[model samples]
Target: MTITTLNGVTLAYDDIAPPGGAQRTVLLLHGFASNRAEGWKRTGWYTAFERRGTRVIALDQRGHGESVKSHDPADYGRQNLAADALALLDHLGVGRCDVFGYSMGTRTAMQLALDAPDRVSNLVLGGVGGKLFDPPRPGAAEAMAQAMGTDDPETIENDFLKSFRHFADEQGEDRKALAASSAAVSPPLDRAALGRLPMPVLVVAGARDDLAGDPAELAAVFPYGKGKSLPGCDHFSAIPHGALKAAVLDFLDGIPDEDDFPPFE
Candidate 1:
């Protein structure tokens, strides 16, 4: 793990280097509340990228993992998060790289491309779409808020377990940090800005995603983006193991086809 100061905040990240000949670099961002370790490492994404001779860097976004955490949810806004990520790349002396993000991380990547198109060579978004900001499901925000306000650790633990036990359990090393961070990044994303991003994109969602938009609607938002729904899966299940691997590989490789293109207006 490496730590760096980006925009006055300390960020934690991991860099994995493949053997011998490495061709390209990829920056992997995990979802809200999850750190880079569980997002990429435990999921075998790092290993997969490594085997393909790609150098992958995974970041623990502000308020998650080992990075800085804040009680203020406003600090986790998309614009601020995006700048922090770009600064991390600059600090590492990386000119540009492929960006892959899942869930909340996916939203961050999309915003990054919009903010610094020149630095993003390719974009891959998983488990989210532009529709999330269109007023959350009835009572959903209230529900999460109520759960978060509980002073009882048992209740908080139960809600967290129900919401993400599979991934949360795997994140034993940074569970508390991640939980705090996820809380900060929450309330989902703001959709109005997402609809206008023109970056070349790849949007992947689970076929049965309970929280995201339908594939067709999601694909329509980007003039150059395509949508792929993993077969027989839901939001979280869509990303584990085989379901997401091939789609990600295909998307990354396809970026070269649009290497010289400009974002659609």
Candidate 2:
């Protein structure tokens, strides 16, 4: 539950270590509107990774959870979001770490790897797409802003409930904030930009995801990226899907021996 103050924001994150194991840390960035607890711990991912001997650091991105909120739409831009992540790493005194992001967080994590390639050792991106774009829904921006502006228990819980069962649900208050975050400005990445990455990358998606394009099409964007689509699952539920999770862990373990970076201490 410790909070780190960095770049004018209080990043609430959970740093979890194994029973008595490695220092290598995997930074977990949750999707939009959702907080760190729901994205990682509540979903059973935190325990899964910890059991694997990899320390996990799950972050509540700015404007969500206990983090600072910026009224300026531009400040919520993807670049700034990515910068916030790097700043958190610096604040933690972590030289390098593995990263795993889902949906909105996947985009942010990808931008971080691109912005600071040397600082990233490995990446596992789930519920991802080839390009960064706003989800298909009306009044998306307004819904997201409302979520950021308030921390009402009922409102927040409602938002999470709405997003459940879909890989990329884009409705309700939290969904609206996510849509707003994506719609506020230009996308952080362009087509073909993902393929140029020299690092090992894993691209994941659900077979039933409506928000993102085809999994094969999305995976085609990354040279080293491999796609795994989970059948009978949608955007939100895909993360918890057995097939999806295994695909991610397998990809992370498949990184070339020499290029692998140690987890954070």
lDDT of 1 by residue, 144-193 (tens): 44444444534554444346534454554344444444444443443555
Compute the lDDT of residue 79 as modeled in candidate 1: 74
lDDT values of the candidates?
Answer: 0.72, 0.70
Give the candidate number with the greatest TM-score.
1
Model 2, residue 127: displacement in angstroms?
A: 1.1
Candidate 2 residue lDDT tens string, 80-190: 778889988887778888899888788788889888988888887788664344454575555544544444434554444344413223223244444345447746376
> Would you list the clashing residue pairs of candidate 1?
33-182, 63-181
| Candidate 1 Cα outliers beyond 4 Å, as residue runs | 149-161, 165-199, 255-265
The candidate 2 region of ten consecutive residues with least summed lDDT is 164-173
Alpha-carbon deviation at 147 in model 2, angstroms: 9.6
